[model samples]
Target: MSVNPFPEMDSVSTAEPEPSPFDPIPRGEPVPDWEEARIVWKSTWNIHVYGFATIFLLFTIFSTYRFLKLYSFKAARMSNGYQLKLGLYIAICLFSLLRSLVLFTDAYNSWNIFPPILAKVLWSLAYPCLIGAFTVLLAVLLATTNACHRGKSLASSYKHGIGMGCCLLGYTALVVTADWAVMYSQRSIFLLVLCQVIFIAWGTIVMIGYASIACKITRDLSRTPLNVDRGLLRSFARLLCVCSVIGGICILMKFYAAVSTFSSRSESEDSPQPWRWLAFETTQRAIECSMCLLLILITGRADRKREILVVPKIMCNGITIISGLESGTVLKDIRLKDKQIIH
Candidate 1:
């Protein structure tokens, strides 16, 4: 964030006029080919946003790995339901790592080097992977909410979120496939806006699902103890809500920009460059992934003395054992090198 993500022009324009969906532009005017322009713009934005993002994401990767190792070593000591939720969170982080790697690599790859057909197919597969990763995140929250209100009719809400997320994931594949086809055939801005529409709709649905889950989590948190897990849940809910709200704003801005490109103009320079803000894509993902990784670490941490987490064997070999964090059960086994086994 060397540069301000948002402009310092007072407040964001809420009442600003939006680009009209059915606006009539002259037939002779051609929309600027953003596909070609984006390569350069992306590089520029990457220099600012991705520089910070890459550093943060790398640190998150290291921290997440350390947390996972610590957690797994003592996982058996955790309650079954707590253990299961932790595992789900771990799975989500691992998948996010994979997605980040793929996205980082693909960002710099030139689609022009390969045959157009093959390139198009690979490109089409890319966004769906991103969408699937998001679905996994939503699934984590969905599971959390269900856990908080177990045996209640919360299943319906979780199921609906899952269903909606899965459908959106499927829809990305269609958008990519159709987008490639239209780009090759018609080269129309209409097709471009249509793709944005689908992307926005998909994002909106996912955000709505998250917001709903956050509301459920809020009610549950009020009655829950102020434990480390509860704290992490609070952090998770806050991060999700902030991200969803900001993401919604960005999507609206993008939509306005998408429509701007279709406006009638004598020159490309005169048209609004809606896609300029698209540079934040990588940065946004990095922030999200980093936030989740933080929550995972916080959840796994042994923040209290006498916290009983590790196995009995781990209590051996001169190792000091404390029991109280999770279960009241104390470690019964003890051993020290060059000395009799102490019990």
Candidate 2:
């Protein structure tokens, strides 16, 4: 047997070489399970915020669109008396649009697809818009009551509006500032709790005052019964009250979370209790969910008409019998025609 001197000739055909590690990581396919899971979570929160914001957006959009069309046609035909309410409606429409846009942008970008700097900057920008819209809303509310009086003068109404707006702005600023402290400084959990408590207390006061003034106006208007649609007005008032109460509760929850957080904080660690974080997060989400539901309900077509006053059915020993009024506005779908109301 001849020994093969050229054993090298044993392997002949060529095959493709393996890729190098230096090669770029190929872009991932559609989405992996982990990625998909993340997306689901993200979408859940997006829906939480968007669900409510979208409701407001669509309601305002259709309302504004129809109003503009009707207003144009009426003006052309020279009929249908217009009032300052038109301007107020327009402002509210714009405000709703702004809020929706801000929230939408924030949510969409929260996916981390954006650069960190951009994300932070956008987040900062979005929150201020929310605050601004709230401020503007309070202004509009006060202005609408310009015809009302607390005592001797109407000037007080305007001042009251301005004051309300300022107070909200101030409260918002403080809250945001404290939030910054949490993000920026080594402030103890106790400080954070204190900040939250102060912020919420002031905010609740402002909200209470706001509701009182609003109810007063509604009462005064009802005496003469202005031609303005009471159904819509009452719905809005109910929304404000419900939202304010929820907001107050959310703030209180934050305080509770903060207190728990500090209680668990060690002098050495900058971090607070893990459970506190969890509680805070849960409460925050709950608040968001509540807001979303309310927004959707606002746009829904239902005439709940929660009456605010109730009378006693019977009396008890040493106690006055009392009953409560249902207080909510049922949303109704209405069609509008050129300078005319349609079924």
Candidate 3:
């Protein structure tokens, strides 16, 4: 038997192309309402769970850095900026780890007919971390200000700082209150929107404060190189701004999509919005990781002697050289007048 000259190739070319895995499937029959709900719920939960994973990875890197620093630095317990910063970072890492475990369990157990009570408990535990992060952010902003440690009489500055800090705290509280209200409304979309607004506003205010402080430092120490890595500082600032804006946008988009779905009672089983949440979560975590990395660069090899008490340029017109000194290393008794310096 002879083979046909034109085999199945001709027919295949005329026939409609078979749908590939990558090809989009056209909507056909409507899915059951209950099945659709389950699908949406699972998809949303998956996104939320993936957010935890991203957070965990960021904190893991930070924790690893902290562990190494604690090991390498002999004076880790000293009451210095390094120690304080390390403590804050470590605490954040621990909090993230705990949250990760809770969210992971929530994802796994969400398959139950009814939501698990344990998941609610786990979420409540995360509330503290949220508050703590905001608090630390405010502190960081204050630290960047000249009022933190400045002038012949910093009493005034201290009072001002306290007042400003309280204001920030109040703002954070309002945000938290809004979050609870939205969440209670059973509107996940609104909750996400509220969270995004709070975080973005916080980040923006902090960044502006930081830039102002950095500028003051530069202007005062114009003669000295300042030794600060300008590139690094700029990178950190840009990262903060970009992450805040991007995160806000992503969250808002997801919130709107969810609202639309709920309002229209759309029966579309497959939801792509969850993927958007995953992306936002990933970006936020990446920013956290970058922050840890920047901190490591600043404090990893801190020189004790070099840790000069930053004074206003006017207070010490003379260049102060800071060098590493072993513990118990004492400087010769040189009579120097006490002068106040702003950060």
> TM-scores of the models, in the given order?
0.49, 0.43, 0.47
lDDT of 1 by residue, 253-328 (tens): 5566455545543244542343643444444555555545544443443322244332111121323222223442
List lDDT for all candidates, in order.
0.47, 0.44, 0.44
Top candidate on lDDT is 1
**Residue 251's lDDT in candidate 1:** 56
Per-model root-mean-square deviation over C-alphas: 16.6, 15.0, 15.2
Stretches of candidate 1 off by over 4 Å are: 1-46, 49-126, 147-169, 187-194, 225-233, 264-343
Q: List the residue pairs that clash in candidate 1.
A: 307-325
Superposed Cα deviation of residue 341, candidate 3 (Å): 22
Expressed as tens digits, the lDDT of each residue in 122-198 for candidate 3 is 44344344434433533433332223333442223333245444654565565455444433443334554555455
Regions of candidate 2 where Cα sits further than 4 Å from its true position: 1-132, 147-184, 188-195, 225-237, 260-343
Off by over 4 Å in 3: 1-83, 107-198, 217-221, 225-277, 295-343
Measured on C-alpha atoms, candidate 2 has an lDDT of: 0.44
* Backbone clash count for every predicted candidate, in the order shown: 1, 6, 1
Model 2 alpha-carbon miss at residue 313, Å = 32
